[model samples]
Every structure is written in C-alpha cells, then in structure tokens.
Target: MFVIITYDVGEKRVNKVCKKLREYLTWTQNSVFEGEITKSLLMKCLNEIDQIIDEDEDSIYIYEVANPKNIKKQVFGQEKNFDELFL
Candidate 1:
C-alpha cells in the first residue's frame, strides 16, 4: 500500500513524530511523508505516532492508496516526483 501521512503537531512533539516517520516513510514536505508500507507496518507506525501526539493538540491525517497504479498524479511548481520514489 502507498501511504501519505501529514501532521499538525505541537511544536514540542513535532520533531519526535517526524523522526519516527522518517524511519518508515519518505519525507515529502514540511510535515508530509509518503511511501509504500505493509499493512502490519502501517499499523505499527500509527501506534508509534499515537504515543507521541497529544490527542487534543495534534492531528494526523493518513491517505492510503490501495491501488497506486490506477492513480494519476499531477505536479506543479517544484514538487518532487512521488511516482518515481514510491511506484
């Protein structure tokens, strides 16, 4: 599965979340990451993130693409080519 993860986290805990995510995903933007990960690994990642974030102060969004080959991505400006990185 291909996953895109983004977070709005408190300043104090942002680095912790980012560091953990980088261990399993590719950092794509300021607080956005994307990569291919197994379902089990995805669950593990989420569990780890849950531990670091404050529920009321932080928010994490995960977009999962079960069939990446069927999706088309259009890039503008200087965005990195995620297709090349994740496909």
Candidate 2:
C-alpha cells in the first residue's frame, strides 16, 4: 500500500511526523510512504497522523494497491497521473 501525505506543517513538526511514520513505513521517494499495512494498522496510523497534525494544515492520502496486474494501466490514466505529473 502507499500513502501520499501533504502538509503545511512547519519543518520541525513535519520532521516529527515523518519520524513517527518511519517506525512503521519505509520512506519512498518524494514524500510517498509505503508499507505492508493491515486495515486496522493503516487506520490507526492515519488517525495518529491526523492527530499529530491536527493543528496544522495537512492532507493525507491513502491508496491501496488492489490490482498489481493493472497498476501501470491504472497509473497511466489521466485522472491518476495528474498529481504525479508535477513530479
């Protein structure tokens, strides 16, 4: 599974959030976090993440990979590639 977390958190607080997530996730490129997360664990982490940044402006995106078979096709679609294009 993958998660794209966007935040306007101050540098210090953002680093804290990243550290917390690092305990459970492997740091992927470009602020994308990845891990083999269970539904319960993922939810828990997300909640925790939100709580940590509750006072800050942040957006957390959680995307589950359901079909490895069609990943390329799915990702290449216009809708999905929109955000990725800036990278």
Candidate 3:
C-alpha cells in the first residue's frame, strides 16, 4: 500500500516524530512522508506517533492509496529529488 503521512505537531516534538517516521516512510516534504508500507506496519507507525504527539496540540493525517499507479502527483515549484527513494 502507498501511504502519505502529514503532521502538524508542536515544535519540540516535531523532530522526534519525523525521526521515527523516517524509519518506515520517505520524507517527501517538510512534515510530510510517503511510501509503501504494510497495513500492519502502518498501524504500528500510528501507535508510535500517538505516543510522541500531544493530543490537544498536534494532529496527524494519513492518506492511503491501495494502488500507486492510480495516483497523480504534480509539482509547481522547485522539487527536491526524492524520486529515487520513492521509486
């Protein structure tokens, strides 16, 4: 499965979340991650994130795409080279 994970987290904890997520996903943009992950692993990732974020002040959104080929991504500004990692 393809997953897109984004978060709005408190400054002090943001880096910690990002670091943990990097273990399972590719950092596609600031506070945003995308990659293929098993459903079980996705749940594990969410659980880990839950432990790091403050519920009242932080939010995380996860978008799942069962088929990556069906999705379209378009970039308007300068894009960093994450294709190698993503592909």
How many residue pairs clash (N, CA or C atoms closer than 3 angstroms) in each of the candidate models, in the order given? 0, 0, 0
Q: Candidate 2 lDDT (Cα, whole model)?
A: 0.59
lDDT of 1 by residue, 61-84 (tens): 999999989779776788863435
lDDT of 3: 0.90
| Reference-based TM-score of each model | 0.86, 0.61, 0.89
Candidate 2 residues lying further than 4 Å off, grouped into runs, are 1-8, 72-87
lDDT of 1 at 18: 90
Against the reference, the lDDT scores of all candidates come to 0.89, 0.59, 0.90
Q: Give all candidate RMSDs, comma-separated.
A: 3.9, 7.0, 3.0
**Local accuracy of candidate 2 as per-residue lDDT tens digits, 7-61:** 4555656777776676666655445566566677778877787767756456566
lDDT of 3 by residue, 9-73 (tens): 99999889988998899887888899999999999999999999999999999999989999999
So what's the TM-score on candidate 3? 0.89
Q: What's the ranking of the predictions by lDDT, best on top? A: 3, 1, 2
TM-score of 1: 0.86
Scanning candidate 3 in windows of ten residues, the lowest lDDT window is: 78-87
Point out the higher-scoring one by TM-score: 1 or 3. 3
